[model samples]
Target: MRFNKSIISISYMLLFFQISISILGTNNYIVSIPYLKYYFDIIVLFATISCILSFFSQTIAVKELVFIVLWLVVSAITLVTTKDILVVTNALMIISARKFSIKKTVQTVFFANLFSLTTTLILFILGFVSDNNNGTVNKHSFGLSHPNQLGAVLMVLILCSAYLFIHASKNIKFILVILNIFYLLLLNSSGSRGAILASLLMFFVLILFYTKPNYLYSICLLIGVFFFCFSLYSTSTSVYASGSILNKLDTVLTNRVRMNNVFMTNYGIKIFGQQVLYTGGSSIMYHADYAYLDNGYLRNLINFGISYSLLFYIYLISVIRKVNSLNLYSAYIIIIPMLVYGFVEEGFTSFLTNIVLLFTSILFISNEKERE
Candidate 1:
């Protein structure tokens, strides 16, 4: 796969900005940078326009064109209703990368995240950035705004590393093992049960990919679908009723079920989207009360609307199917765990944090080729 050099550079720039902003944006210190918010907006705007112009220079298949038009229209509506530009920007970034090599794109994202995480850690170690304890002695945020944020970033990095190790290096299994051990230690230190479980699940999937290749695709699909449905069901039940089982599950999820219930009760689901102020974790320092919806499925439904949430899920299923057909097990392996993690973490919604979201372009591009 070949791309114009200028297009490739622009895409890398966009990826770097998105990854850096998403990772560092969670840092209490980075957020304090003067005009940082405006800088992000300007970068996004520039990238969006550059991506659109680049698309015009390429020959898009009819089916691909239709998909892009429909997606952009929906994203525009989501932007207007949700007041979140990340959705539209994410869509554009994926569209822009349709012609680029998936391996190159994944490598770019992996290195970008690696750099961002390293820089943040160094700052934290130097005492330039303060770690958030959230009034807990056992949990540490590692210079992030919250402990979960640290775990979530590590989870993303691990997923990326796993993909690269599997697809890009045949001799790195030992290194991968060491990395997983290190990740487990960090996750334990942060007390992020969700990330810990998700990372373990990812490791299990990777082992299954080698030990039970035939069952890999089906199992992954089932896990993703089951968790997504479970997320919806748990959130709904938490809002209306409670039971011993529900209480135990809520306790295990650190009261996320109850918090989601609070958000759902206050602001019902919307078809378009609505603005909801989230406060909890480090946010409690400013707000008197604590409230936050950590479930990605519910968060998208409440913040981006049912339409966007449904379409996003449908798109994910489609990508899984397409990648399975293409024998892209690396992508499949990375995506499924992220899907499961979404049940407990909201970062799964962002393309920057969840690189699997960018794999949507592969589905469209492959479809176009098949048509040809």
Candidate 2:
């Protein structure tokens, strides 16, 4: 028997973001290979391989049909790596914890994190794996950029998995708080300013400034946003949009300004995948000042085109719209995090972790059955 169409469509769209990176990683940045490409390049490669291995072994989850549709689109435009497809395929399996047992839910989230986090930590350890007389800058193995981002991602997953486990298995808020403190610190320390800021933004906008906020909350939120944006305006844009912005405020508004300029100028919008038209630089100099907006909407418009950007936003916002008025905290867990973290890290743009999120979300959200 066929499954629900809504689930299929949502899942497929979620997968579309990953399809872009198959051509080249580094977010289209000019990657200078130290030895191999960077560790993240390898991570994506591994994700694709792992995903493909799962498929051949018949361990592939039966994804929503829309996933097939999205896959076709991916195959048509970009080289849909086996690894990338496999990552989405993992989400296709309708995961549930033995008839809604919280224990199962906690374990599922935790075990999943264990696999990803262990891999990430290994990458971290491997950074110092080599013996080099000169400080040649291991740019790839472990650096300020890739591994740190991966580590931050794993850290967030660790906290979230712990949250799910604590509540599901034993209902311990204290443990959740302590772990969350560590998560926040790791998020900030990982140098992923986006992840750190996004988490705070999620907590602020979704939790504090959500609706009719009390006066104190409103004042506090405004102050926070003002100070945050102020700081981002002061530093650098590349880091904020590419990484995280909260702790550093590092350079978000500049990125947004550039994007806003692009949108203001019609030439910035690309219908098909054309880098020249959007990035506003000569082909030769493209790599010199090549930068994408830290803002999510801007990045889409710049890379994939404005139309794709709109579609992506619509799809993401749908999660909120669908969950609206449902009063589901589980749903809030994902929604809040995406909104917060998305500002900097491109959480939605990331592959393996995002699949875990989208799959887990649909499990509890009401929208899965809406168009069934």
Candidate 3:
């Protein structure tokens, strides 16, 4: 069988992001990707060049440039004061990597699910040996404790939704949809409320992206679910996501309180360069969730200051609108989940998380003009 160029292109794209992330993600505690903190600029610079080449060659969308500019501005502000610039680089790299089509989009989704499942299985075994003592559900895959990984799950789910809405499929598509849902459930049982919330938000996103009559669409979704569940087997991990859907929902909101306080504080809202002077939380840091922060908006203002924090939000919202205007509902699917979850979790403020979000946003923007 002949391989399609779009498949080849997307494979290359996912490879690029995956490699960069693996090389950088760590638990050293000083900051996940310190290299990203200082030198990720070089990668972004290269990504800028790549996006331009794709645009000129008509291989990607011109709206890609909008993201590049937004990233550059936020990155510059973040670096000038905080001297950290990973998000900028990741954002550009993300933009240049993904320009989704059916085949590659599906591949992207499969690979993401595969990776997530593999990781979950490994952890599950580890938990079994430790008699489930080493890690607990509430703290593991879902919260600020693992935002980066949780963010990845959300990205893949968004990509899957993008594929579903973009193209009409047959019985196989329905099966694939069911599988994705169960796979998502298995991943969630590993215990992450953020992931759960993110998935639900995307369900509605599909509705928003499609401009046609949505009532009739319900039949299509039911078909997809049937196909999805039909493939279940005995070895299939039967562990229901351990707790209530309302399970850790309160813990999520309580943490939001301190985050809110972060924003509510005057120091949190200062413009760029002001962070250099406000050394309050710099010396003191812990897990955003295990710690406590109620106000999401206020958290950024205090932690990174008003300018850097606000720029981050602006970058996110602007990219969403850009994708929506282009009518790439899948990209919208990706962002909506994160937006809803952002209210209860503080990962939105982490340099690592923000960078990941930035990069994913760019991919959707570039994919706006991607063909069927």
Please tell me which predicted candidate would have the highest lDDT against the true structure.
1
Residue-level lDDT tens digits of model 3 in 1-372: 123444436434644454344323321232243564533444455455644443433444466566556656766676677554544444444454444343444455445445543554454455521112114444344221243354445445444544554564677577657766665655455454555666665666566556542332343334323422321111122211234322233344433333333323324345653442222142244323244442234445544555655566665555555554554445444445555445544554442232324334343534533533
The true-structure Cα RMSD of candidate 3 reads: 11.3
Q: Which of 2 and 3 is ahead in TM-score?
A: 3
Stretches of candidate 1 off by over 4 Å are 1-5, 30-32, 46-50, 170-177, 237-243, 281-288, 366-372
Residue 111 of model 3 has an lDDT of: 55
Q: Which candidate should be chosen as best, given TM-score against the real structure?
A: 1
| Predicted candidate 1 versus true structure: per-residue lDDT over 268-357, tens digit per residue | 889878888886545542232557778888888888888778778887888788777877777766787888888888888877677777
Q: What is the C-alpha local distance difference test score of candidate 1?
A: 0.74
153 Cα displacement, candidate 2 (Å): 0.6
- Comparing 1 with 2 on TM-score, the higher-scoring candidate is 1
Cα lDDT, all candidates: 0.74, 0.39, 0.45
* Candidate 2 vs 3: which has more lDDT: 3
lDDT of 2: 0.39
